[model samples]
Target: MDIRIKEAVDLFQEVMFYGTERVIKSIDDPLWKEFSPEQIQMLKLVSREKRITSSRLAALQAVHKSAISSRIKKLLQKDVIRFVQTEQQDRREKLVELTDRGKEVLVQSDKVLTDYIENLLAQHVNDEEIDQFLTIFRKLKDIIKADGVS
Candidate 1:
């Protein structure tokens, strides 16, 4: 591999670390006490899928079914999500759906996060730079998708 490629990878890793930490801190400051990151992700997934089984959510997330148990439990306890009866009528087959409160949380959190990032970018960068950053980010996303790098 080229030395410059290696240097670029290292720089990217450092930038990602710091960037992720800052974003997580900013988002978690107000919400972390109530919900863990896993719970939030689960809520988002359920909100998107409308109705999903625990095993299916684990599969979609590429995690073990047991790994999702605690997060699902917490969401249920918080009334963010609830189990719904499926047409199959199998009581043991865990099907879950988001509650109205969960939907509101998902929408509000998205708005808050978008506004926070947009404000931060606007404060430090012009529109052209923002567009350039988005272009590069989209290219990286495409590469990741092509490589199946979930």
Candidate 2:
């Protein structure tokens, strides 16, 4: 019985992984070509503030400066992110910000992603299942956090 439960759990997790891809694909054609996940996240972050620092981004995403630098370069090349050198004492600090197009993409892509998730929930999940899943995941999250996860 224990083996059967574990097998079922693994199988269900695999199916849900593929299911997320399929659901995201339903919105991919018209929007994904214009925005990647990192782009969307950066846009959303910068949209919340006029300017943010690279260190702040690295801290939030829990990545090294080099990785964030590479991503920021790509965003800069795509015209989705901008940087300004402020006149403050710390001239080396680049004030990274999102462009108008970046914010627009974030807002629009967020709408499409929300609609896709909503449709998927209606088709594949009931309210009780969602509530249960969230409860379980959050509980696990709390446990991991309590363990002092770095």
Candidate 3:
């Protein structure tokens, strides 16, 4: 690979891996015991959609149905998620929604992560750099979306 390409790849790798690890570690707390990253992601999706089926969640999360099932089971046991019956032909089928506690956890986690990122960025870069980074990040996202990657 060209030297420029190699440098870009190295920077991307370091930023993604080391940068993400530092951010996550900065916010490590007791809530992590009850919720893994996967579970938190699933909960956020469920929170956005008033109701979502396990199958739909699996598809959205790009994981196997069994993997989603296991997470659902754990969430259910923790009382973080609950299943509600829809008025459909199959009563057995149910949609998942976050419980009150789940919502609280989600909200708390969002605040914690948001605060951590804000402080971290403030410590490392100025507002001007944030604006520039956001512009580039949004453009990169648009490019990825247009390319139909994933």
Cα lDDT tens digits for candidate 2, 1-150 = 699889978988987778656766667655677666665676777777678898878887678988888888888998878998977998988889888877777778878888878886899899999999899879988998899852
Worst 10 residues of 3 by lDDT: 24-33
lDDT per residue as tens, model 3, 1-150: 699989987999999779767866777777865688889889999998879999989988899999999999999999989999988999988999999999999998899888888887788899899899899889988999799852
Candidate 1: which stretches are off by over 4 Å? 1-18, 88-92, 132-150
lDDT of 1 by residue, 1-150 (tens): 899989988989997779757867887446655776667778888977889999888987779988888788878888889988887857678689999999887887777678888888888999899889889889999999799863
The candidate maximizing lDDT is: 3
lDDT of candidate 2?
A: 0.79
Q: Which window of ten consecutive residues has the lowest lDDT sum in model 2?
A: 29-38
The models' CA-based lDDT, in order, is 0.82, 0.79, 0.88
Q: Sort every candidate by TM-score, greatest first.
A: 3, 1, 2
| C-alpha lDDT of residue 66 in model 3 | 98
Tell me the spans in candidate 2 whose CA falls farther than 4 Å from its real position: 1-26, 124-150
